[model samples]
Each structure stands twice: as C-alpha cells, then as structure tokens.
Target: MVNVFITGASGFVGSHLTPILLAAGHKITAIARSESAAQKLEDQGITTIRATLEDIDVLAKAAGEADAVIHLGFIHDSRSYAESVEADLAVITAFGTALKGSNKTLITTSAIPVAGVPTPTELSPGKIPPRAASEQLTLSFSSPEHSIRSHVVRLPPTVHGDTDRGFLAHYIGQSRKAGFAGYIGEGENHWPATHVKDAVQVYKLVLENASGSLKGGEVLHASQEAGITLKTIASAVAKRLGIPTKSITKEEAGQTYTFLALFLGIDCVASSELTRRWLGWESVEKGVIEDLEGSGWYFEETSVTKF
Candidate 1:
C-alpha cells in the first residue's frame, strides 16, 4: 500500500478522493488546519497533521516520510491572489526539496485557465496566468537532474457535483439575488467543466501508475467537457430559479456577478486526448448541463455559500 501525504484532504475533491484511496488500501497522512477537519480525518482512520501552507518545514518533513505526495490545497482569495500563488510555490518547493533525487511521486493541482490557449493540450508552453509559476516549478522537479517524479493535473473551472459550493453555486446565488440570471453578450465565451467524481479519478489513476506508466512532469487534463457556453449555464440557473435569463454588457457583469465577473466571460476550453491516451482514463459522469438540470441539489437550497 502507498503511504500518501496529501494536503486539502478535507476539501470537496479531497473528501471524495480519500474514500477511494482508503478503499484501495492506501494509508493517508492529511494536513488539517482546524479541529473539526482533524476530527473528520481521524474519524475516517486517516492520520492528521495540524498545519497550514506556510509550515514549510513541517511539509518538507512529511514529504520525506511519504511514498508520494498529492497537493490539492490552494488559497482562493481574489484580493490576495498573488500571495496565494506565492504560498503554493513555496509549498511545492518544500516537497521538491524533501523528495529530490529520491524518485518519489509528487502531484500538484493546476487549472486550465492558466494554459492561455484556445484548446490547451499537455505540451502547451505559455505561462500567462499568475498561478503558472507553481505549475512550472512542479514540473521542473521531474528533470533527470532532480530525479523527482512529478505531475500536474489541470482542472476545469467547473468541478461540479452535489454539495459543491464553487463558481456555479456562486452564480446560482447571484441569480437568486438579482431575480434574474445574467450572462455576457451572446455568452459565447466557454468554461471547461468536469464532474467531481471524474476529476478525482484522475488523481487516483495518476497515483496508481506513477511508478509504472507515468513519466515525470506530465500535465493531465481532467476536463470531460472541453467547453460549455456561459449562456447555456446561465440558462440552467435561470430555469432552476424560475427567473428570466438576461444578456448583459461586460461592464454590467461586474456589478451583477461581483467577484465572478471576469471568470464568467473567459473562454478556457481544454482537451484531455493526451491524458486519456497515456492513462486510459475516461470520464463517465453526466455533463455539467445535465447534472445541473437533473441533480435538484443545486436549486434546493435557498442560500448558496460562496467558496
């Protein structure tokens, strides 16, 4: 069994992922920042380490002891996004130092938006986004000189499932607050998506094959649906809220969606063809629109919590 060290083990994707790893006989050492989170992990028979991202020494020590490390923790604050990115880079650096020349596996999470391409593939070379530095650093550990087996899994904007309090949930909340769902002009800009279940499996698969099939520094895309139009997503929210869907100007989207305005208008389509070919992974969950319309969970709550 693999002795895995994981950050963000109590989070949305991590919560789903831990169960699968446990079922597969893997031992998990998870980082928990709160008593409640620690209790939750302990209840599930996981070893908990109380620490935050800034604890580089503690993170490095944990990485040294584990057979592999999966970093899923990220700060999502928009106001201090640069600081969040800096923290992520520092955390990855600690892991790299601990595992350097050991040939151990290290998997770091990234996003498709950072690819800066119409349809980003595994080999895309642009680092236009702020979070790109972390991605670049994670992959650098895989070079022959460093001797660390590293991989980057780029997630889509919408990792949707029940109990999801992400971007889509925020959009739903905005629709409720405004009494009408709003989208940018024509809403032609697309947002890539994947069900949480499908997304988690990619990590599991990467862990399972890290030593055997995976080459170091590979970038995997977990996006099942390359892109879905914002108009379509807004319409789904509108139908659920029983409100009209309105097309708004980019200037007006800022006032309507608040922090979500910029994301609502970005086109971040991505393809997983290479990832599928390399890992033989397939996404079997329902698509975003289908899940939104059929789940009944997204609209059941009167209040949506922003994540």
Candidate 2:
C-alpha cells in the first residue's frame, strides 16, 4: 500500500476520499491548520501535520516523506482569488521540488471551467482562467527528465453530495436570500457535473495506476453529466427552496450574484471518456440535477457566502 500525503483531507471530496484510501490499506498523512481539524483526522488514525498551504517548507518536507501526494487544498476566497492561486502555485512547486526525479505521483485538483472550449476533452488546452497557471505548471513537471508523475484532475462545476458547500450550495444560498432564483438570459449555458462519490474514485484510480499506464503531465476529467443547462439547475434550486425562477440580464446577474455572476452563465461542457478508457473509471452517482431535486441536504442551512 502507498503512503499518501494529502492536503485538504478534511474537505468535502477529501473527507470522502480519505476513508476509502484507508480501507484500501493506504497510509494517509494529512495537513491540518487547526487543532480541531488535526484531532479529527488523528481520531481516524491519520497522521496530521500542523500546517497551512502557505507553509511551503513544511509542505515540501511532508511531500518528501510520502509515496504520493494528492493536492485538494485550495483557498476559496473570491475577494483574494489571486492570492489563493499564488498559494496553490507555491505549494505545487514545493511538492514538485520534493518529488523531482523520484517518479512518484502528484495529483493536483483543477476545475472544468478552466477550459474555454465548447466541449473540453482531456487534451483540451487550458485558457486564461484563475487556476490555469497552476494546472500548466503541474503538467509541466511530468517530463521524464523531471521524473514527477504529475496529473491534474479537472473537476466539473458541480461536485454534488451531502455536506457540500460548494458552487451549488452557494446558488442555493443565493436563492434563499433572494425571493427568486435567477439565471442569465434564457440560461442555456451549461455546466458539467459529477457526484462526490464518483469524483473521489478518479483520484484513487490515478494514485493506484501511477506506476502503470498512467503517465505524467496527463489531464483527466471527472465529469459525469457532460452538460446540464443553467436554467435547469436554477429551476431545481428554486423548486427546492420553494421559490420562483427568474431570468435576469448579465448586468443584473453581476449585481445580484456578485462574485458568482460569471460562473452562473458560463458554459463549460467537459468529457471524461478518455479518462474512463484510460483508468477504467466509471461514474456511479446521481447527476447534479438529480441530486439537487432529490436530496434534502442542498437546501439545509449553512454558511456559503464565499466561493
């Protein structure tokens, strides 16, 4: 079994991923910034390193000690998004330095929206998105000369499951605040989605197959439903919150949705067929619309004001 070092181990996807890895007999060492977070992971028999993403030296040391590294830790602050991206880049660079010429696996998390194309495949080039720099850098470290088996898992817009306080939850919260759930101009823009359960399996498979056919600098999409329209998703949220659905203009969306305005109208349709063929990975969970309409957890009270 591999000794894996993970960032964001207590996060939504990471929380689900950790237990599965442990069950599969892999040892996990997680970085926890808070004592409570550390204690919680420690209680689950995970070794905890008390550090944040900004602790590059600590992160490098931790990366040097592990057989593999899964980077899921990202600061979701829209107000300081550039800073968050910088921190992510720094952490990735540190990991690459520690694992250089080691041929160990390094899986970094990115989003499907990073691809500006109509239908993004694994080979689709990243555009000028917020996290594009980190994605490019991660893939660049996969050269045989570097010997770092780096892979980037581009997660869809909606990684839905219970206890999720992501973009979907933010939409739900916005719906609750406003009388009606709003979408931009006919709301035909689409978003790719996947369940948390299905998304975590991609990470596991990537780690497990690192020494096999899986090569460095490869990009994988964990998207299940390729394209769920914004109108459909908005309507689902409105129905769940017992609110009406409204069509708002782009200007109004900016004013109402604030930082989430751009994402609300973005059309990011991504395909994971290559990833499925490469790793034999199959998505076995409900899609975003299904999960939103069927699950009661999405409308629950939670603080999701930030991105």
Candidate 3:
C-alpha cells in the first residue's frame, strides 16, 4: 500500500477520492484547515494534518514524507483570482522543493478554461490565465533533472453529479431570481463537463498507473462531454424550475449573471481524447444535462426562489 498525502480532502472531488484510495488499500494523510474537518477525516481512519495553502513549510514536509502528493486544494475567490493563482504557484514550488530527487508523484488540479486552444502568436505571459500558468509550472518539475513525477489533471469548468452544488447550483439560483433561465448570445458557446464519479475514477487510475511507466509532466484533461451547449444547460434548468429559457445579449448577460457573466459568455470547450489514450479513462456515466434534469436534489435547491 502506497502512503499518499492529499490536500482538499474535504472538497467535492477529494471527498469521493479519499474512500476510493482507502478501498484500494492505500494509507492517506489528509491536510485539513479546521478541527472539525480533521476530526471527520480521522474518524474515517485517515490521518490528518492541520495546514492551509499558506503554510508552505507544512506542505513541503507533508509532500516529502508521502509516496505521492495530490493537490486538489484551491481558493475560488473571484475578487482575488490573481492572488489565488500566486498562492497555487507557491504551493507547487514548496511541494517540488520537498519531493525533489525523490521521484515521487505530484498530482495537481487545473481547469480546461485555462487550458485554452493553442494559438499561433504564442500566448504572452500576462495573457495566460493564472490556472494555466500554474499548470505549466507544475509540469516543468517533471524532467529527469528535477526527478519528480508531476501530473496535472485539467478539469472541466463543470464537474457535475447528483450532489453538485457548484457552478450549476449558482446558475440555477440566479435563474430563479431572474424569473427566466438565460443563456448568453445564441447559447452556442459550449462548456466541457464530467460526472463526479467519472472524475474520481480517473484520479484513482492516475495514482495507480503513475509509477515509472507513466512519464512525468503529463497534462491530462478530465473531460467527458467535449461540448455541452449553453442552450441545453439553460433548457434543463428551465424545465426543472417551470421557467422559460431565453437568449440574452452580452450587455444583458453582464447585468443578469453578475460575477458569472464572464464565464457565461465564454466558449471554454475542451476534450479528453489525450487523457483517454494515455490513462484509458472512459466516462460511462450520465451526461451533464441528463444528470441535471433528472436529479431531484438539484431542483430542490433551485425551487427556492428567494435568497
């Protein structure tokens, strides 16, 4: 059984990931920021370390001791997105410092939005999204000279399932408030997606297969649906909430979607073809729209028209 250290043990992906690793007979040392979270993990027979992303020393030590380190922790403060990106860079650096020459695995989380399509002009440093920048930096630690097996899983903007209370939930809430489910433009812009179960399966596969066989600096996309249309998503929300779906202009979208306007207006489409070829990850679970329309829990939350 490999000894693994993981961050974000209490999050959406981590919550599901911990059990699968345990069932596979691996011991886990989870990093937590709160006593309640630590106790909860300890009760599950997993050891806990109290630390935050800011605790570089603790993170380095934790990464050094474990056979593998999976970093799933991220702060999504929209107002401080730049700061969050810097924090991610710092965390990766600290982990690299600790695991240097150990040839251990470092699995960090990234998103497809930041992994935009290749451009001809070459992406300027300032033009690159913080998440994408962090991903590249993590992969840089994978060379023979570095001696660290660094892997990055680029997730879809929407990682959905039965209990998803993330972006979709927020969108549903906004739809109810607006009295109509809205999509920007003709709603042709697409968002990539993956079921939480499928995502968990990929993580397990990566951890299991990422020894000497799977090379370091590999960037994998955890995308199931390459392009789930915005119209389709808006329709799902509308049908469930007994509301109408409408296309809103860019100017109108900013007013209605608020902080989510930028995302709502983006195409942000991605694929997992490479990931499937490399890791043999096939997503057989339900699609995003199907899950959203069928999930009773999802509708229950959106049923609340008031804040």
Candidate 4:
C-alpha cells in the first residue's frame, strides 16, 4: 500500500477521501489543526500530524517523507480571502520545495471558474480563472522536466450529494427565509456540478496514476455535467421549499448578493472529457436532483432563514 500524507483530512473532501483511501488499502498520515480533528483521523486508522499551514517545518518534513501529499486545507474566510490566499501560496511553495527531487505526487484542489467560457474544455488551457489564481500558480510547476507530478482538480461550484450543506443549502435556506426562491436575472446563468463521491475518485486516480505527463502536471475538472441552468436550480429549490421561484432583476441581484451576484450571474458550461479520458472516472454518485431532496434543509431551518 502506498503511504499518502494528506492535508485538510478533516475537511468535507478530506473526510470522505481518507476513508476511501484506507479502504483502497493505502496507508495515510493526515494533517489536522485541532485535537478533535486529529482524534477523528486517528479513529479512522490513519496516522495524524498536529500541524497547520503556518507550521512550515512540520509540513516540509511530512511532505518530504510521505509517498504523496494531497493539499486540501484552504483558508475560506471570506473576510480574509487575500490573506488566506497568500498563506496558501506559502504552504504550497514550501511543499513544492520539500518534494523537489523525490518525484512525489502533489494533488491540490482548484476550481473551473477561472475561465469565463460558458463551456470550457480540456483543449482550453489558457482559460484564465479570475477566481482561482492559485491553480495557475500550482500548475506552473510543470515544465519540460520536473520530478514532481503536481496536479490540480478544478472542483465544481456545487460538489453536491447527500452530505452537502454548503452553497446549495445556504441558497435554498436563504430563499425559504426570504419567502421566495430567487435567481439572478432570468436565471439562465449555469453552474457546473459534480457529486462529492465522483470528485473524490479523481483524487485517487491522480495519485494512483502519477507518472510522466502528470509530472508536467495537469489540470483536471471534476465536473459531471457541463452546466445546470440557474432557472432549473431555482425551480428545484422552489419546489423543495414550497415557495415561488422568481428571477431578480440584475440590479436587485447585485444589491442582494453583492460579490456573489456576478458569479451567480455567469453562464459557465465546463467539459471534463480530459479528466474522464485520463482517469476513466465515472461519477457514480447521486446528482444534484437527489441532493436537493435529501438535505431537507428547506424544511428544517425555514423559520430563521433569509435569502
């Protein structure tokens, strides 16, 4: 079994990934910033490292010795996005140095929103993702000859399924609280989607198939469907919450959602043919349809919710 050292093992993706890797008979050493999270990793039969992004020494040591390192610990404080991004860069740079000569695998998470194409394909490499600058930096490690097989998996906006209480839940909850399910203008801007289980498979496959071209590194999109229209999503939420789905004017969308309004307004349809062709990945998990039905958040937290 290959020994894999992973960061953010306590995160949504990491939580699912650790068990999957363990089931695949891989030995794991998970990084956790808290005792509770560390204990959780230990309970899963994986070794634990009581360290965080700031602990450069510990992280360097861990990356140097492990067979591979899958980084997932990203600071998500919206209030401190820039600071968190800079810190992430520091951590990645440290790991890149740690695994410089070992030719080990370093798989990190990125998103497909960097480019504005309504539908992005593997053929579109220079697609500049305004939201995902970190991806560009990580994949830059690729060169004519680099020992490290660094790769990026651009996850969907909604990495949904039964366990998702993230964006979709928040939006639906907000909608119910507002008394109407709302989507930005005409609600035609599309968001790509992938099941959490399906996304996890890409992680395993990249680690399993670490080799030459991967050494130059690659960008993989964990997108199941190219696009799911905002109108459809609004309908789903409306139906689930028993509210009227309505389209807000562009002006209102901006006033209500602020920074998120632009993203929610973008029409993106991303293709993951490369990810599938390369890894033979098949997202066999429940799609957004079941995800909306299962969360039951629409019914549970209705009274206090605000759109």
**What is the C-alpha local distance difference test score of each model?**
0.90, 0.90, 0.81, 0.76
As a TM-score, model 3 comes out at 0.92
Please provide, for model 3 over 70-183, each residue's C-alpha lDDT reduced to its tens digit, 9 standing for 90 to 100. Answer: 999886654477898899899999998999999898999877777455310112122347677787878888988789989888777788876566777778888888989999
Q: What are the runs in model 3 whose C-alpha is more than 4 Å off? A: 77-79, 118-127, 210-213, 302-307
In the range 1-307, model 1's lDDT, one tens digit per residue, is 9999999999888998999999999999999999999999999999999998789999999999999999999876554778888889999999999999999999999988888888788888547667898889999999998999899999998999987888888888878888899998898889999999999999999999943678798999999999999999988888878999999988888898887897888887888998888888899999999998897678876646555
lDDT of 2 at 233: 90
Return the lDDT, model 3, position 1: 87
Model 1 sits at a Cα RMSD from the real structure of 1.5
Order by TM-score, highest first: 2, 1, 3, 4
Q: Give stretches of model 4 more than 4 Å off.
A: 126-132, 210-215, 297-299, 302-307
Model 1 worst lDDT window (10 residues):
298-307
> Could you tell me how far off, in angstroms, the CA of residue 42 lies in candidate 4 after the best superposition?
0.9
Stretches of model 2 off by over 4 angstroms after superposition = 77-79, 302-306
Clashing pairs in 1: none
How well does candidate 1 score on lDDT at residue 241? 81
| Stronger candidate by lDDT (1 vs 4) | 1
Q: Which sections of candidate 1 miss by over 4 Å?
A: 77-79
